[model samples]
Target chain A: MVSGALLFQSLILGLLLGGLYALLAAGLTLYFGIMRVVMLAHAAFIILSAYLAWWFSSVTGLDPMISLVGSVPLFYGIGYLLHRYLLSRLRPTTMTMMSVLLTFGIALAIEGLLGLVWTGTQRRINLPYGPTSISFLGAQIPVVQIISFGLAALSLGVLYLIMKRTQFGRSLRATIQHGQAAQLVGIDTTKVAGMGFGLGLATAAIGGAALSLQATIYPSLHWHWIGPLMAIIVVGGLGSIPGAAIAALALGTIRVLLEIPMGPTWAQTIFYVALFLTLMLRPQGFFGGRLAQRF
Target chain B: MPNDSEVRTAVAPPGSTAVARLRSLGSGRTGPLVGIVVVIAVLATWPLLAANPYMLSAGVIVLNFAVFATAWNLMGGLTGYVSLGHIAFFGLGSYGTGLAVIHLGINSFVAVLLAAIVVGLISLLVGWAALRVRGASFVIVTIAIVLVLLLVFQSWRSVTGGSSGLVVPRPFPDMLRPEHHRVFFYIFLGLLALVLVSYLVVDRSRLGQALKAIREDEDKAQSLGIPTALLKLAAFGISCFLTAIAGGVYALWFGDLDPIFQFDVVLSSQIALMALLGGVRYLFGPLVGAIIVGSALEYFLLNFGETQFHLVATGLLLVAVVLFAPDGVLALGAALIRRLGPSATSIREMSAADVRAQQDERAAARGAGAGGSVTEEPSERASDD
Candidate 1:
């Protein structure tokens, strides 16, 4: 039942996809880390970005990579404006529950808008070199997969640099660790929160581009993505970046590997299974409490 | 994402005491009773009165969602576990009844009841495992419940009929096609009435009080000798059971079980919002929310033809409710009624000083919200009958 080479291929593909998943989840964790808001709109935004990418490349005749230059900042600004105008106004005591409600609403609106605009028909990007594959340890790896993986890595690296080295990163982390204490120390937690939300949304642009390259896209595809992404966050631990990243890669690999035996339909369940098992045994998440103490 | 050290923002919520006082300038007890009577009369007469089929069917859909929102409130409003996946039971009911009817050749009515009981029993097991984790974990666990079932129902093609879905045989074959809406409307309205009466019973019972205490602060209730876990599980079971019955009835009436629509998280969220929009703390919160939201949805579909504006409308309403009326529209209505209507009832209008005192009390509650002694927070539900 277990073929070695196929398993290796599954592993490689799973890891590549996982890298992008990590990027997608990074924004969710960032928002949660700073504001304790489980932004359900994150998934819908990714779907929105994917459509943006599709429209951009189709109209401009440029690579989707080029589309990201415009989309990333555009999404970031939207997130920034959203936080400044709307989310910032919610009371701290009820922010978590309220944000979940608000974001779900936003997500629905976005989904409906996308459906109206895109007509709910499925579409995928056509990279000239998308179908070509390269030999990796005698297992064929798609060129797009390699490039997307590279993109995800570069984005993640920049994210890590911003989180670890920048003054903003310090403030963000401080707020995540203790918001009141951060404010007491004169950190503009509000501004940081807005920017953090923007940064989180900014990733959606890249994630959308990455997702469009790999999968079939539709207006309601966000629902499919949200479940696995949620599983990743839960297994990774709330508000923990490294934890989410690690969980994404592991679960993503398992999900792809499961495809061989379980078929794509059944394998899609791997995320929920991982989530259920994790919730039963380790509700705080694998990297939540013990591994490298959450920020 | 449980953050205990959240900074209390300086911004006052839009529906603060100031708004309540302004609203109290119009709020009352008899007003809602009168409103309920008007609603019942309107609903009862609508089917009998000369009307087109479209309006009649809309009424049925509204009642369907009304039942869902009310069932969802049994746990979400009362026990404060906002489950986004409660619709999983609804979906299971669809499949369970469909499969039972088609495979076992059982009577449709019997299948409906059987499916509900089976789903309720399943919920107890699921709730036992899920209730172990609270807050965000519980949310994810519930989502996982739906996701896993989606996979099972989707991949298990032999049993569930998969994406192709099962066609449930519609009951009352003797009735004509146009008569379906009229019959189901009465069925759902009667169902709604039963659910409302049950809600009132729970609201007045010891269990309801304990549940409200749990909502206020679960750990405090647990230490005060309330069986927190068991009660949550029980509430979750009942919530699932009722939701399943609604779904089963829907299956029997509609005769389709598409996993996508049945297990929809968006629909579940919408149900959750309906409850929240009405005032989850109040006994009639779900019914009020259901009527408002359900009618609004129907209006959206009617006005914005050939577009998905209804989804956008639902989204906007959810946002507006969370932002401006977090305590719900009924609470605001009650506030207004207290202001304008004569105080024939025992309800007293809250003064500015009383509002200030209440704000301080809520602030103290927030302090207890994060870290507290394992103790009880008394349930003082905002009044409604």
Candidate 2:
């Protein structure tokens, strides 16, 4: 019999971690949805944003949260340019393979650049409320985690709105649903694809800011996150944001809960195992069934 | 049949049989075999020519990677599986050899053989599980295997020595001095030659044709009654066997085993990158890639040990190669020669064009067949029209 308090704490912690994972997967799924390119550099971009946040906070004596205001748009423009100039030129038949290689190369370059600039030393955002905890339903929760969770929720909400309410959203959805039809219907798919990629990167900036608040980060920390992120997006169902978000939560919970019985090191294996099993058993994913035959 | 002959004529061109035969003599089966022999002969006598320990040691390391990359190409290059978890087998072999020599008190050669068989079985299992998925999913599964193995090895401290790693007894301790680098260099060269020979034999066999067919279209190949899954597993097993041998040799030479270095994703990525950089489809691609990448890495590390400039350079090289020269350095070189040299038209280009045309025709025929099937149900409408 597990103690009520331990279960409660695990639940809260899991949800919080999951919330952040959802934000990360949101960007990845969006990219996959629009471009049919698995952006392996997603975690690298997140780490890059974290570094940016760290630098901004250090230089201006401001909270890392403020870095998102500038970083998101900047990342958006970068993503747009990357798609327009480099990614768009690839043949559709070879896009998956080539994109993986291209993104992996980009990830390597970014990691190397980060190492050159800041060295391999781990860095975390030192917040005033870092050590402080809030008493929530008799459980002590870190203030930074609560804030990170809140930020993740807010960004996800905004993403949902952007993906549903706006005209651009409709066009993006149409293009994702049926590229040829959308093209025939006068949707400039190329433009939508570029913007969609930009939106994905903008979310990465937000996720990065949240990640900075949650944990210690280094240049190569992306390696640790890549497997889990891939797992979350894949489990959530490649292009489905809500599905990804839900899967992220479940996986995050499962991961944290596994730590109770299996120890921390083994807890890290849960996502990878989950990813492998999911790919084997249900390659279309939970929300990806409709889109499976098309891909 | 007439169309087939016309296509062949178009691909080969007239009045070029003599030149084609000469080119074949230089590049065909006999050519590469002779080339390999000549290179080996030169390398074998290198110690007599100049017994440079440093150069010989570097050469050994380069050849070791060449063997690994060639093993990887057996599956990745030929079958298009692109497994990123090959380091798992390498690590397993390292540990297997290390454990056998240390605990079982076996000779290094026996340990190597034992490790190869073990890794081959493991590859069969892994290939069965992972190869069910296609494209990116397959890649992800392969990476996951490496990550899982890395964690398992790291945590199983009692057996694997965990993160601190295990130290193995070196084979031939009396001859372990730097002066004996020549012997190890020859050993690595022989291993590389063996790997290349295996690749050649496989590439020439019916099994190779089946593997290539699976690479082209699994569904079509399956429809034609090809045993794709079994062939893939076999290919993966062979690939793993060669890689494990290399790993065993590395274990005996290096005398230490660590999960981080042995099962490193970086090392796996480097192997894949080198294969692609040299040209994966070509038999000699990995060897060329290993020589270039391994030498460049050694030079950079020697000069800039403190910095990760080499990784950046590698990344740039990868991006450039993937984008501009997906067919690889060999193809790029051939293209350049054809464009700039006396030959206005090359056999490679002609054949490439012919292949593309054939593919287009097949696709058109398939489309028409589908149309015919759909129209078959409209017999009454056709009569009314």
Candidate 3:
């Protein structure tokens, strides 16, 4: 009963949607891999970027893509400073719990500030081609969705290259493998951690930009974004970048397919039900075979 | 390296009789009893001193949060199972009681109790599966559960009234007179007292030490033949039981309920914040944290309602506390109390263990430096004890 054209269209939508989630989860997994710290404020960062894009578009008539360049580094710096000055000071055992609360506080602060500036209204960052659609294999795809997917893929590819080839990447990997060993080798662990956190925030900026195009952006969007983001990271495996990609794609595909069959409202519940089952049955994740020691 | 360090590194066998003796002593009721009594007494008399409806109303809300936070802390703080989706349990209670009243014409008291039991059983089932996973996975499982509940409550219009939510008639509609502030205030005060008493009873019992041991070192506790799974489930059930009770009370108090508000992730985060701000380690940490944070939000930051002051304050406070005073507001109070009280031997005794542990860790670090390897028995054992 499944048409090839329908399957292709669903997959295209899923892959495009997956890209945004991958971008969002990339920084979270990387941060966890390096520092074993889950920055729960990551969704807040995504929402912040959306707001940032919304502001720039309204005030200066700049596009979201242009806003990305400015917002990414700004968030990176904020994240770096947070890691260095605040998060680094906590005990390792308590780090995750405290981060959850601390980041939630940040989310609250950002949401509050956003409300003050923009009120509680939902906004959309409309690209020029937002309403434009193109036919592909007997199905239609939105231009903005395609652009967002391309942007996400390109950034992720660049990130992968940096991690695999750069000196800083090697140092980051070393630290993830054994922090004490990395520290012994004269690697400035603190500096590396800050940069890693910065990189994570930078990805969040991309995620925010991508999300604004597809969904309605608002101060409360962080609330909606956090659960799904957490689901992706956890379902993907705590610190695996590729795992996040796969998980995002899987979830995205499930979401779209479920939406068609069950309707949007039922599909939303089904998505979480799938996530809950995945987590309960396979804590290490489908691809996270053979549990590895975290640094 | 040194005899002191070696002594510190000595790993006590998990099943050893000595460790068992220590657990009994640590969990003894004598320690937190007086402090609990004084706190309950003060709370009971608070409205008499303030006597203002606004203050009483605020107090009622604060107490409600304290109860919820305390319940959350038992599972999260005590058991190290961080659940971000605790609001799922609260939602169950809210809806459970609301539906019972609206659909079945159940009495408020019976409905509330039933809601707690229902939520508790659900938590037990969820905890059994969710707690199987460690660390971040546990957090995700809880969030998924909450999300599922949120979406269900929103989509299932026949039962839940869709996204707009279901409103229940006030449990005691006659108690709605503005002049009845004293009546509601006393009810809230009683609930708060009941929560505090039950928490203390559990905390001061032997079960508390077992839970703490599991939190501190699950493997070591497991090796000692502690049925960690059962204990964790028990804690999770108790925690949910109390949280559901609070939710039911809140539903009754508000007289209106919505899926969005009842199941909001933000409210769950607020409970976690209250626990952390007060001091997750102490029994009264959530109470102290809720009072300080809640009052500051209500009184001082009302002017900045247009801005993100509350969130900023929460974030800053969390950062500050984690970096500087992870022990929380309760620790500050405890420190003040210690300075006023006569020199207690317990302080010296506790510090001795801490000092030994630190010295051993340093020695282990130095040895690790020389050999490029460390024994699991020494390092892991130190972590365990």
Candidate 4:
């Protein structure tokens, strides 16, 4: 039998990791919801933001969190321009295939640029609170993880407000549900699409900042994250933010629990296996309702 | 749109010997056949003319990539199911051959064949499970499969040698000499030729037509009783079999199989990108793409000592190709040729006829199958949207 303390610790850690995963997957699902395009470069953009955070911290001797002031808007503009100019032009019939290829190309370009700028060496943000921990219920938790988890929850909460309370949010939801009807209601879906894409990238800034605090950063680390992020979104039900967030937490917990028995290397396989099994059993996903078209 | 003379020619009254002779001369197959012969002649003599180990080795690598790209195109290009994880089969083949030779004490040729059969069966199973999902989900599943396999191969130290990798025994241990590169180069060339010929044959068969139908509109194809799932599985299996053969040859030629490189997602992307760059619809597209991209990659790696600048170049090229020349560079070349040719209008009309013929064939197929009227709605909706 497992010790209560270890189980509690794993549960806490898993919850925190899941929060971060939710943050990462939120942008991807949002993009998919609005544009019906799988932004494969989503992980690459996160890595780029992480690198920006790392560079900002090193140069200014400030915390990586402070760098979000610059990174968020920068990535937002990039996303805006990407959708406004390039992705918007693709025909809907071929958009799925073309977007994948286009985003994959962009991912490669970003990876190459990152490699050229910083090399491929792994780096992590060395904050003063990195090692500091607090005991709760006789289990120690790292302060950085708590902060990262808090940041994820805070950003997700803000995103929820924006998606629910605002006029733009209503229009975004309308467009996602029924584009033709949304346009008929004067939603200006093209504009909403561009802004929605920007909002997705904006989340990457905070997500990356939180990620640096939790994991080692590198140019190619995006490759490792892509599978898990994809799993979270897919398992949560594509285009459902709440579903993605909850699935992220559940998957995160499952991953940690698997790690206990299967070792760390095999732990990474849990989500991929989950992704496959989920795709096989329910392509519509757990929360995916009418969106599940028969193949 | 046909003129009176054109209609008469097409109708071709019985015993029109002269028109038949003229039509045979103008058949599209002759040009490609001549091009293939010229390409083969040049490749067959390259080793004799250059006679260098480096050149021969480079040729072998290029040809291996050509084969890989062609095999990938069989599924991705023809069937419109972009598999980002095709390297799984490649990695499997590499390990299968290496393990068989090292433990089972089999010859390389037999090992390669064994690996192909093994991979083919695995693909059959994978296709059955994975092909049920369409579009983005299918892509994600493919990627997941590769990731899972990479982890499994990395952790299974007893069989795969883990991350440290496995070394394969040379195919011809007693014939280790300077000419070995030449021999392997020819062997790689032979494999490339085999896949190329297979593609050519399939491109003309009912299977190719079925695959194209699926690519255009899978739902519509299914409505027309095309059995889209079975055909897709067949394409996936054939693709896996051919790619596995290349990987087996690669295992022997490279001499060491590492999971990191063998199961690399980047390699899989490169194969797909090369096929796309060369023009997936064209028979010789992947070969052309592989030669250019593979050579450029080798040159950059040699000069810059492993920087990813080459990848940036490749990415830019991919973006440009997708945006401007989605049909591929060869199509661009053909268009330019037609534009500058003396009989530009005649060439345009001829191409128009070709398109009409293809549409007519598809229409005939649809008419013969179930839910004929349903197919038209999707096509109209696609254009309308």
- Candidates in descending TM-score order: 4, 2, 1, 3
Q: Alpha carbon lDDT of residue B133, candidate 3?
A: 72
Off by over 4 Å in 2: A290-295, B1-27, B42-51, B345-385
TM of each candidate vs. truth: 0.86, 0.88, 0.86, 0.90
lDDT of 1 by residue, B350-375 (tens): 45446556755775686578666422
- Give per-residue lDDT, candidate 4, residue B274: 85
Error of 4 at B271 (Å): 0.7
Task: Estimate, for each residue in B9-59, the C-alpha lDDT of model 2 and write its tens digit.
Answer: 443446878778567555564555656667667767756765567767777
Candidate 1: CAPRI quality band = acceptable
Span of 10 residues, lowest total lDDT, candidate 1 chain B? B1-10
> Which candidate order results from sorting by lDDT in descending order?
4, 2, 1, 3
- Candidate ordering by DockQ (highest first): 4, 1, 3, 2
Across A137-171, the per-residue lDDT of candidate 4 in tens digits comes to 99899998899899999999999999999998999
Q: In model 1, where do residues sit more than 4 Å from their true spots? A: A290-295, B1-42, B342-385
Candidate 4 differs from the real structure by a C-alpha RMSD in angstroms, to one decimal, of: 10.4
Report the lDDT tens digits of candidate 1 across residue range A1-295: 7889988999999999899999999998888887777788899999999899888888887888888989999999999998998898898766766787888889999988998887878888888997999999979999988888888899999999999999999998898888899999999988998999999999988889887877789887888888888889888988789999999999888889888887898888889878778767877788875321211
Pairs in steric clash, model 4? none
Give model 4's docking category: medium
Evaluate every candidate with DockQ and list the scores: 0.43, 0.37, 0.38, 0.50
Per-residue lDDT for A6-121 in model 2, tens only? Answer: 88899899999999999999898888888778788899999999999999999999999999989999999999998998888777766777777788888888999999999999
